[model samples]
Every structure is written in structure tokens, then in C-alpha cells.
Target: MKKLIYCVLLISNVLLFNSCTDDKPIFIADLGSEKIAFTNNFASEYLLSKDTKNNIADRFIWNASILGVNSNYEVQAAIDEAFTKPVSIGVSKQTNITVLVSQLLELVDQLGLDEDPKTTDSTGKPNNSGVVYFRVKSKIGNGGAGTQEIISTTHMINIKLIEKVPTSTTCNPLWIVGDAIKNVGWNFSKTTVCDSDVQRVKVSLQNGKFRFFTAENNWATGLNFEYYKGKGYTIDARFKSEGAGDNNFDFIGTPGIYELVVDTSKKTIVLNPSGSFWAVGDATPGGWNFTGGETAIVETSPDIWQATFKFSAGVFRFFKTQGQWDINNNYAYYKNAGYTIDTKLENDGSGDANFKFVGTPGTYTVKINAIDKTIKLN
Candidate 1:
């Protein structure tokens, strides 16, 4: 019994020794370096707006090794190098952060020598060529405590300085309009006249076409027309006799092949050789026309008219029109001799009226027929 007890005690002591030898605590020393890279270029200017007044510390300090840096690095450029030691531009205590240069800096940086170097220039300003460096040490118990020992250094780029010349008094066509006017205001073609604001100019093109005047002018039968799709076209725009006499109108489309036709017929005037007629006062060009002699009486109304003219595909504008009439009479008289008449045309159910023709030239045939056939007595 004594010999068996001795054997069991020996085995237990061996097992305890083996366990103690296999278990050991591990110690690892982390001494890794951290870097915060940046460039002093035009693109870097955004950092100034981002770090305004240096009150926001989050933008500057990226890692524990470079803590306390803010976006105020831009103001550092104006600082006098005579100051005691290198000042901190930006610092962050975060483990990892990425910094970008201002767009302006990036632009100027690309131009090799538009800016000066470290030495003061004739104006006695410090040269901005030198790059700024940063470092950060982590505090105990902080998650980034291990990175505190690392230090990062980088330099600002040197750029050449260029002289500014006074702008010329002469105006440049391209610069006069600038980028703002490229696509502003409502697109006239897509919007109705009632929806458009006053004084808005819209552009449209037709080979040769005519449109009506609005009720604001007593709904005169005289309308706006243009022609420029052929050798050249003519425009005939009639207005209230008191407004303006028939003045030679300009065409908005290609200046060569279209023409505007004004039909003073009191009855329905077919705009196309086909049987359709345009509503009096309703300007429907790209249609047809009929003639009225001195004694021939045609009715007048405040409706739109139509006429069709053969045209090749092209952009055109009914820019201007011309007519002759007495101030007291709203009816337009042919240049020779004629009396004014009225056509009683009203607005199509929609309570809106305006005299503006803006359209694009397409191959599709347009038919302009009249509505409410009553004739007006002037």
C-alpha cells in the first residue's frame, strides 16, 4: 500500500509541472508610424471654409499622433514665419483620417511657378513655399494610446507668382453673357402664353406662318406672320390701329424661305388649298390665304386664322410684321385702298389670350380651322 501511494504522488507532481510550463503571458509592443499627408494648392482652399474660425476641431485632428489640428491651416499661409516655432496647422486625435487640398490650391499648384517660395518678396511677405508638418501623442486609457508615439511630416508645395493685368474696357461677346444665362427662365416653347410672365421673350421657327393677336388689343383680326423657307418670306402683323401702323416685320426663322400672310376676310379664309379655314384673329401660318378687293367685305373676329405654305425642313421665326390702317379704325387696309371690317372671334373655352407664335418646324401637316362662325361689324 505504501509503494502504490508513492507512485500516484509522483504522477501528480509531473502533471502539475507540465501545465505550468505550457502556460505563459504574452507581451507585444506596438510602435507603428502614422502619417497625415496634405498639399498646399488651390484645391486646398475648401479647407478654409470647412475650418472657418478654427472653432471646429473635428476637421483638423485625424489621428491620435496628430491631435488638435483644425482646418485653420489656410490662415497659416498669412502668418509671419518670424513666429517662435513651427505652429500647428491642423491636428486630430482619431486613429485614421484623410485630408484633401483645396481646389484652388490644386489649380495653382499645377502651374509650376505662379507663386513665390519661402523668402519674403519685394512686398516683405513671407514666402508660402514650405510645407507644414504635424504630430500627435495619445493619452493613457485612450483607444489610440498605442499610436501616440508616431510622428508624421509633410511639406507644402512651392508655386510661382504671376502678375495680374487690368481687364480691358472692351467687352467680350462670350464673357458678356456669362455662364448664368445659358438656360434660365421658362422655356417658351413648352409653356402656354398665359403661364408666361410678362416681358418674357420666346423663340419659335416656322417655314412661313401667322398667329393672332390677343383680346387685350380688342381681339383684332390682324395677326403675326413670318416667311423664310424659300428665297425669302414676308411678314404681316396687324395691331390695334392706335398701337402701331403696319411696320415691316422681321422673320425669326431662317431668313430666306418663309413668309407671313394676313387674311382680312370677314368669312372663313382657308389657310391651305384644302377645305379648312383658320378662325378669324387666330394666326395659323403654314397654311393658305385668299384675296379681298376694295369693295369685297370680309368679316372680322377675335379668333385665330390659319394658312399653309409648302416649306422644306428648317428653323424659322415670325419675328416681325407690317400693315396699314387708320388710328381710329382697328381694321388693317391693304396698302392701296380698302375699308376696315371686324370678325367676331372669341377664345376657345380657355379664358386666356395672347399673341405669340413660337413653334418648331416638323414634317407633320397642321390644319387650322375656324370656330364660332359669327362675323363682327367694325
Candidate 2:
């Protein structure tokens, strides 16, 4: 009977071991798995806009940090004052989550990501190429009855500092009314000046075209001229002589038979005109006077003759010598009723001559050049 009892106990032990083996294996879920990721393309430094939603399971959280030394990282989050409320399309429960973000070089600790915790090394050291980490947790409850914790997957985003290249663009100068050539982006340095940048873009008035140049082939700032699009006026230039070796000269309030010469070699312009000249005895010339006026004389060479006078809008008649035809109007005549030459009887040939006008209250400049022997105004 004792042997039978011992055998029975052994049989029961074997049965129990077999039963345990037949049971299913226990499975543990990977709590370190991530459902989402965040990546920085290094496009813009500031947040363009928010793209968050109110859905519980579909919500997203983003953070960044500049990796620094000694485990000190400056952090910033997408949930700053700029993104106070999440952009929502439908009704959903909102949960408060803090996102720490900062420059990439300051990040120290990194959460467990889905694939692997990408760090400077396996021991969590600083790396030349930095990483931004985001930790998010969701809570759903009102007062105390329905509180629940939902933790998001940790996401590690890789980042690298890169140097940007400069760029430029070019286009034709002429465009139709109400039309615009757009998207001409240019890269500019902090030290660029308006004159240098303007000169970099060459405008050809002869061919109505422009050329842009830069160091690289990138999108550049573009410029275009719209013809007859709106009300505009032409820039009329003239010359006036204060006196010999005198830089101060008033612009002649007349336009005709003037010499428009631009010598780019010396960066100077000389305008010489003949016949009726107007002058103001005082500093301000309100109108043309026939007597008691300062004589407008020509000066030495290499002078900026056209730049001496201020310009305004008005019709000015200039005395064109015989055989000197007008470019705009072909009609040419001498001693016509409209043509008036006031020759003073001064033996010195330095007397006041006035040109009469019946027009609007616009500005004008009369240029008299004794060397060129021509009278013109605009």
C-alpha cells in the first residue's frame, strides 16, 4: 500500500507539470514604442503656424532644445504663448501637456524612442549633430470621476547646422499694365547697401531689359517696370550757371533747343542753349523778369551742368537755331511770332533776357551755354 501511494503522488506531479506546459505564453507589450515622430527641415527659425487638432488619440506634441555642456539644456515648446489653444476641427477632450524646447546644442536627456534612443553615444554624451526630444502625456477628466493617464511615444529628431548660399534672379524691364512678375527671391547679407544692390541689377533703358547677378544660382529678388500702368511723369533735367567757379545756379524755367550731353567718362553733363533767358533777381525766382536779374553764364569743363538746377513740370519754349531741328516736333522756323529774342544793348553782352510763358504753375530750368551756343529748358 505504501509503494502505491508514492507512485500515485509521482503521477500527480507529472500531470501538474504537463498542464502548466500546455498553457499559453505570457506576452508583454513594448511600452517604449512610439506612435509619432517630429522632424526639423531647418527651413525657418520661427513657427510659421500651428497644425494641432483636438482629437485625443490623434493629438501631437513637439519640443526642441539646444544641446549644451554639463547636462544643461535650454528648452522650448510648441505650446508657448503663440500656440495657446490647439487648432481643432471637431469637439474633443483637451489635455494639458508641457513641451520643453530649446536650441539643439543644449539637449541632455532623451526619452526612449520607438526604434532606438538616438544620442551622441550609447552613454548619453553630447554629439556634434544634435537631437531634439519630445515627451507628451495626456489626461482626461473633469473633477475626479473620470481621470485617466495617456502617455505618448517618445520621438527623437536629428538636426545639423548648415550654411546657406546666396542667390539672385533676373527679368525683362517691360511688363503689361496690371501684370507683375513675382517670386523673385534674393539672398541678402546683413551688410548689403541699397546702392550696391541696385547696381548689381543692371537696367538697360535702350532694350527695356534688366540683368541680375549673384554668387550662386538661387532664387533672387526681381524687379520689373510696368509701362503706362498708372499716372506718371517723365524726369526732365536741365542746366544752370550760378557763375564762373560758382556751384550754386538756379534752373532755367524754360525748355527748348538745349544741349543734353552726358559724358560718362568724366561723369558730367553740359547744356548750352541760345536766346530768351529768364532770371530772378532774388534767391527765389517766382516768375520770369526782363530786368535786374543775375546773368546765367557757362563755367569751365568737367562740370555737372545738368545737376545744377531743380526741375519742375511745365511747358518751356526754347529758341532753336536755323537747321537745328526738334526731335519731337519737325516744324522749325526762325523769327516766328512764338520765337522772341530779347537782345540787350549792353556792350559787355551780359544783360538780363526774359522768356515769356503762358502755362501751368510748374517748375522749369533754362540752360545757356556760351560755348555750345544753344538755349534749352524743360
Candidate 3:
């Protein structure tokens, strides 16, 4: 009876193992091949001088991969046949992308394809006259599963040659138009001159929006350029006012007195906080020590500063800040006591002599022109 019971239990265990094996499902390989390709939708030629509106440079037409549900596509162009060094012309999740003629020309020159004079056709004619190669790449996955990459075949096209138009070197007049700027006076009609050649101004402004203008406080008739906000200190901010129409640049930084450097020729605007100007020496009313005692120079004009004080028989110079005699702080000036009365402020590292009070110790007034680096005594 014991042997018969053990045999029945072994049969039951074998049947349970067979049932478990039959329920297990097999996983077939679902891998798919990713293939990408590009097509030239327009003519094989392009000219830089032509200003046509709808000149199609190239169109990237590719097949969708079965494994990739939402694959990203990037169109590439290069000078090499292997596309080892290709420039990305456009990127999108769509299977097709159309590049403009202007953009393709820019890429051709950037890839150094226009500089090659060795590529020739069957007739020995130079084919390197702006020959460009195009390709497409597809990336299949978004970090959720296995990622696969595929590259397309290279396509070639010739770009026509044209005369290069020179960019304008003459700068137009620029003005700052905003409600936050008030210290320099809201007289938008007045162009505040900061540098001799570079149009600039020192204005007290609040954290708000501002923009550059060609006309006085007018945005419709004149040229205007707009850029994004939160630009760091003294950055060479640049923008083209050609197609920007009428838009204002956002300023979301701390509010204070700022120095604006505007160049219309290069279409750039740079802003830096204006450093404090003080008169610290024997001739100043605050004495010769600048550690604690210093005479603050009031900014009468944009970059011009003025101060009036009784002078003793001694020497003095200008200080940008109160701290030390580093390059950014203190400097001497070259003074001409002749009929012209010119003062050459030492901005270079050249050592200069201090301004000497030659007259008798008495009550006198002094004016400092920080822009032209001149001084007037009366």
C-alpha cells in the first residue's frame, strides 16, 4: 500500500510540471531596421543673389521604423562624401524637413565646400563651385527602451556663384526708450552721448522692459531691434532690427545706474553698471585719504561728472572706486594749463602726474568732465 501511494504522488507531480511548461509563452525577436533618406525637392542649383521667397534647398524624406514609435529626425549636410563632419541643418520628429536656400548657402560656406577648387566633372570643369552633400539621421527611442541610430545616403548639389554684398559699416543713431530710464531725462529727442564715436549713455533704470530705437521715442517709423532678457553684466548683446519690426527687450535685473554702449553699425548693445567716481587727494575737500573719507563726484551729464570745492596747495587725481589703486580704481591725468585748457585722462597703463593746485590756497570751484577727461576750474 505504501509503494502504490508513492507512485500516485510521483504521477501527480509530473502532471503539474507539464501544465506549468505548457502555460509559458515564447518571446519572438521584434527588432526592426531603421533606414533614412533625403530628396532634393527643387532645382539642383541655387544662387546667393536671387531673392526668391520659396526656394527649396533640400527635403529629407525618410521611412518610419516599425520598432520606433516616435523617432526624432535630424537633417545633415557636409562637404565630405562619408559625411564624417556634417552640419545639422534641421531637426524634428517628423519624417520630412525642408531647408531654405539662404540657410543651405550659409551651411555650404560654413562647411568649407565653397573653398574647394579641386573637385572637377568629366569635362575637367570645376564642380567645386559650391558643391554640397546632404544626409539624414534618425534616432529611435527616448530612453524608455533600446535605442537605434540610422544614417541616410549622401546627396550632392551645386550652388551658383554671385557677387558678395558688403555689410554696412556706418552706424545709425540709437536711443534708449523705456519708462524705467529717467535720470538721463526722458527727452527721447535728445541723444545722450557717452563715448566719442560709440553712442552710449549712463541712465538710472528700474527692472523692466526696454528697447533700442532709431527715431526719438518712436517705434513704428524707425528701425528697432529686440532680444531676450536677463543678459549678464557688460555682455556684447547683438540683434538685427531688420525684421524684428517693433518689439522691446526685457530687462529683469537689478535696477541701478547703468552704462549703455550702442553701436548701430554692428547692431550691438552692451550694458554695464557705472562705477562710482570720487575725488580723493590733497586738493579735495575730503582730504587725501580715500579709505573712509572721500568726496563723491556728482554725475551732471551722462558720463560727465562735476564737483566744486576749495582747494589747498597740493595735488589730486580721480578715483573710479574707493578701495585700492588697482587698474580699475585710481588713475592720474595729464593736464594742459595753456590757452586751450585740455585735460588728458590717463586710461592707459602709462604713469601720469597728478593735477597740481598752482594757485593760492583759497575758495575755488572745479568741474570734471569724465567723458572727455577734462577739468574746468573757476
Q: List where candidate 1 sits over 4 angstroms from the true fold.
A: 1-23, 33-84, 95-148, 153-378
Could you tell me the lDDT of residue 301 within candidate 3? 55
lDDT scores in order: 0.28, 0.29, 0.58
- Ten consecutive residues with minimal summed lDDT in candidate 3? 337-346
State which candidate, 2 or 3, has the greater TM-score: 3
Give per-residue CA lDDT, model 3, range 1-378, as digits (tens): 999999999999999999998997876334355555653243446554335323444345666645544547787877668777777888888777666666766654654443334555467765435677877777664435566676777778777645433444554557766655665333464455634336777776675445666676566543334342232223343322233334555455576667777654344567777665777767667776767787776776566666667777666666665644321223332232222232322223323245556676776656666556656676
lDDT string, candidate 2, 63-164, tens digits: 322111112112222222332322221221322222212222223222222212233446565332344444443333332443443333444445432212
Error in Å for residue 150 of model 1: 0.5
TM-score of 1: 0.22
**Error in Å for residue 96 of model 2:** 6.3
Residue 188 C-alpha lDDT in model 1: 18
Order the candidates by TM-score, highest first — what do you get? 3, 1, 2
Give the range of the ten consecutive residues with the poorest summed lDDT in model 1. 172-181
